[model samples]
Target: MEIRLRVESAVRDEAEELTSALHDWLREDRDVGRHARIGRLADSGGAPSGAMSADWFGWVQLIAGSGFSTAGLVYAHNAFRASLPRRQQTVSVVIEHNGTRIVLEDASPESAARIAEILSGSGDDEEAPGGSS
Candidate 1:
């Protein structure tokens, strides 16, 4: 599988930083192919400050194929949040595959696990995006 991650941020610098961090994690920890491409979506003036809104700012998309598994994407997101200070940071991750899109918001471990399960097709719940559990 070819997995591509695109991060969009109101802050171009922050988005770029996230892209770099994702690339490093995927490469070093997940053993992703060095050629796997991870990109940063240019800021288009629509990024939510305290919430995960794709309205104006930026978001990240991960596309993976044969050599990559959905689990890798989940792991990367978890790792990313783990490295950050929780009280000041919030991350929203969305995974799209085969027409199925699963979104996970907040920096909680449970959310990450839910995202993984959703992506893996083990989760049968259909909750609104960014909605409470």
Candidate 2:
């Protein structure tokens, strides 16, 4: 699955750096490293498309492959959040996966995992009694 993660910051200039930081952080994960990459959105002159901000630099794209699990992506994201200082605060995060958009503003581990399960379609089986599919 392809996941687009954008770090929203009040400082427009900081957005790009923050996104790159996330990409680097994700690479530290053995499983998520190779699959994670920084993605760029092409600019159309001075005005950007209605779909996104013109000033928006880009975001980190995490494509989970056979070697990595969706859970790893969640782990990397949370870890990155924990690494941030107060000065480098991120307003929020918009994650788009398979047309399912999830906006997170300081979500807890449980909440994050539950979201991952939901997005990966793993919650259904786990929710079933005796783990039946």
- Assess candidate 1 and give its TM-score to the true structure: 0.52
In candidate 1, which residue ranges exceed 4 Å CA deviation?
A: 2-4, 31-72, 85-88, 121-133
Off by over 4 Å in 2: 35-56, 87-90, 121-133
The 0-to-1 C-alpha lDDT of every candidate, in the order given, reads: 0.51, 0.61
- Give the per-residue lDDT digits (tens) of candidate 2, residues 20-62: 7876787777768875554554322232123345655566777
Tens-digit per-residue lDDT, 18-47, candidate 1: 556655666565534342455444334454
In terms of TM-score, the best-performing candidate is 2
Model 1, C-alpha of 102: deviation from truth (Å): 3.3
